[model samples]
Target: MLPKCIGNLSTTLTAFSSGGNRVFGEIPEEIGNFVNLEVLFMNLNQLSGVIPSNLGNLRNLARLDLSDNNMGGTIPSSLGNLTKLIGLSLSGNNFRGQIPSQLSNCRSLDSLDLSSNNLGGAIPPQLIGLSSFAIILDLSRNHLTGVLPKEVGNLRALTALDISDNLLVGEVPSSLGACIGLTSLRMGGNFFHGSIPQSIRLLGGIEELDISRNNLSGQIPEFLAVLHSLKILNLSYNKFEGMLPREGVFKNVTSTFIIGNNELCGGLPEFHLPDCISKSSKSKKINIVILSTCIIFGVLGVAVILAFIYLCWLKKKVNKPVPSLINSSCPNISYGELLKATDSFSSTNLIGVGSCGSVYKGILKDSGIAVAVKVFHLVHHGALKSFTVECEALKTIKHRNLLKILTVCSSIDYQGNDFKAIVYEFMDNGSLERWLHPSATSSHGNELPKKLNFIRRISIAIGVASALDYLHHQCHFPILHCDLKPSNILLDAKMVVHLGDFGLAKFLLGSSHDTVANQMSSMGLRGSVGYAPPEYAMGCEVSREGDVYSYGILLLEMFTGLSPTDNRFGDNLTLHSFVAAALPERVLEVTDRIPLLARASVWESLVPMKCLKNG
Candidate 1:
């Protein structure tokens, strides 16, 4: 909303020579006709529009600053014609374009900035001059590409250089090691490759350094790892390889430095890897070995030997157990007793696919107890990680409606092997999805239960919403359920809702970035397509609001018997909008018939863009 032109204002006063005068409003296009104007000082103004091309007529212009404006569009190419120009800054504006290479021809040009714009293209290579003493240079966040020219090393006077966030590639020029006077160097989030030049290792006066999120490879230069004066060093998400030399640098890192590479393994503190192999792969092999020993001994051992082992194992089994996703008995469980309880885990005893495992209804003969046993899948590492996270989270989760995790066995069989499983309080009724969208029912594949009535459906919806709200917002750390479909929600004997499946739950309390949910654009369109929000496509940093959006869609489906992702959203559409349109005279026509049989909210608080949102 800056003033369009100066002539539109009431003031036009030419000040006495050599006096400092303050002026307001935007520069007029006609002002370029100030033919004798040699010292233009419109540095900070609420100005709009590009500097007039006619301003290039100031043959003797020394200092020019049209900075801090609402200016849009390209910097005029004509400005470079000023042969006598000294200081130039079009900084901090909406102005965008490649730095005119012609300005470098101005031999006397010094101080430049075209930062924070949507400009694109490569930095000009031939622009560096030996005679010109350019001081400050900043060209960050533009779409500029290509390598930083080695000629820049010739700028012995250049104290600060920031070309961060551009598409520049290649190694940090070796000659940069000679720039001992450099106070700040920020080249983050680019494609610069190769190791940190060994020559730069001697930069004793350096204060800041950031080379994160780039393709830079090779071990971090050893000399840099020991620099005490350095305040910040971020080499995260790069291709840096090889075990860090433990005795020297990186020994006392205080700030965050992520070095997670697939090959850079086993050398860290948490990952106690053996010299024989990498940590992750070694853990997998150890698990395999433990599994083999348990199986071999189980088949050959006699009853006496088994009894001795069981009592001995019990002493070690009752302590806090290792985390697991599938709730099952301890690894050294009484296999024979469990087998007898399930009639040898018979097909008749099989229940459902519970999470990453198969569930079986078992009754202990000795105790006359009913329990559900979930067996781990043969090959599911994803299921394994999920199992571990859930075990940890559920250890603290104690809710009446939720399915309670009882215990899990983490030992090997008589053969001296390891198998994972968990035990949970069983539910007579399965998931809500089974009743609402029943395809098949019962382990015998019998007909699904009768369709739920309106009253029951609303109850289920309310329960589901409450569970979702708790998980999404009320938990100690807000847990984001990336997947929130009906099948994942279960009900108890009392018809109380208990949300299951934290396989995709992410703690959002202090997360700086949205993860897992972001890398889901492929695999036939991400996140169940219809349920995912629109902003997800733009990678706009998803929040708990996404879960809220999914819940709203579910509520809409509960009342309308139509999927929210259906093709009826905008054409006089949306369950909420459609229902609201039929208000006043006949709210009945707009009602979700299931709720018609029960007391409804009356939607007395409903309005446009209200709680019952469509988008």
Candidate 2:
């Protein structure tokens, strides 16, 4: 139970968060006394009882989240008094009654989530039509009824919208297509009728769209097949008909779902859909004479083709050099070419060194394209295995925030020794480690000092998180980075982050198989010493959590400018604990001085840590 005395800080508190805790019992009504509170988060708790109506008294509140709790009772209309509120989430609760139309008065609101609740009644047009909703507006898994208001077009800035699994009826509003910022839209599990609106083509950037289990009919839209960004599309259990397009996402059955739509046909062979045939063609009867002639000709054509193929194979075997399996997936770059590109492995071209290899700046002679060449030292114990693992991992995964392999080189060097290398696009800004802690002996001594502002640091963090999310959840099979640290994070010209260095990558084959493989692979440490998780040291099986632990340490290091293995962290005191003990009050003491050099006061320096703490 929350202690009532906790509200005594109302006189000075500006923010309060107790989310994801085991706390229970009713919230203290005295919480309304925090006139200066700007943010309140108590989500993912066991709190119950009605929201204290007096909460509306906190007129300065800018964000309020009490979601994923056992809280019940109607949403109090008094909440309308918080005109400055920017986000309000009451989702995953037992709250009953209609969504208070008064919530529309929060003109600054950008995100409103009332999903997974017992709320019923028509979705208030005033609330749904709020143009201030720029981030998301989720009312899914509720008892909402009536058509989505046409005024939804007013929210042209909204990025995601979900009204799935509701009592909604009528056509999907064409006005929704006007919100061109949408990346995900789900209106499935409802009674929505009619064809997909033509205006939907305007949302060219939509990535995940689900309109399944509805009454929508007509040919599956050709526009969907042309949506290059479309990844996960669910059109199942609808009345869609006609030939499914063979282009774009339709060609990948694993990412697109069309099951239960009986009339749909002519998709990928993996879909096992019936061949689409015109009515006239289906009704025509073939003559026996023509059929026999076609059979004879087809056999003759097959025999001729086989003979030609065999002759071509024999000639090629004698005339051309066969490509290696590694070269088959990548461009056919010879070891000699890589050697020339790196100026015969000159010391001047060396940019970074790794456990198994050295990365050199190089330029392809023919194309004049700048590249980063990672040439493995084959003599190193695990260098061969590292090169193989990196190639296997890179070939299967591709994402904007993850590094891209341009080609691979596998052949004999001038000495007739095995040579292995991986080439990647050159990053102008270089690795995160160089910026976070510049070396006094850096080759570029004439260059000015480098620093990352608060915003840039946050952007880098988000990019790294996105890359990890893709590897862990969005791949054909789960992949674990195993190694995530500052040195592995690269920055491009625009300062966009790209996660690289996958030599320690591991594919999770499934639960039991993964455990056995992990144990076998645990013969050595999975990642660098300080960044690896403690459980890994005990021979625990590799899991996604291991990556997250490394990411957490990376975050602390990013803001504090202190490595996990920094000498200051000794005895029982670690970097994480050192920072944790100085937060909210002594935030500036532990934070890197670079971000604070331009700040005016202690309050200004707290911005970054405040956001991290609240989240």
- Top model number, TM-score: 2
Count clashes in each candidate, considering only residues at least 3 apart in sequence or on different chains.
28, 0
Local distance difference test values of all predictions, in order: 0.60, 0.83
Clashing pairs in 2: none
TM-score for candidate 2, residues paired by index: 0.47
What is the C-alpha lDDT profile of model 2 across 215-316, one tens digit per residue?
Answer: 789998889889999998999878899899999998888989887788988878899899998777755644555777787997889999999999988887
TM-score of each: 0.46, 0.47
Model 1 residue runs over 4 Å out of place are: 1-26, 33-46, 59-62, 128-134, 202-204, 226-229, 245-252, 259-615
Instruction: Name the regions of candidate 2 deviating beyond 4 angstroms.
Output: 1-330, 511-523, 597-615
lDDT of candidate model 2 versus the reference: 0.83
Evaluate residue 293 in candidate 1 and report its C-alpha lDDT on the 0 to 100 scale: 75
**How much RMSD separates candidate 1 from the native structure?**
19.8
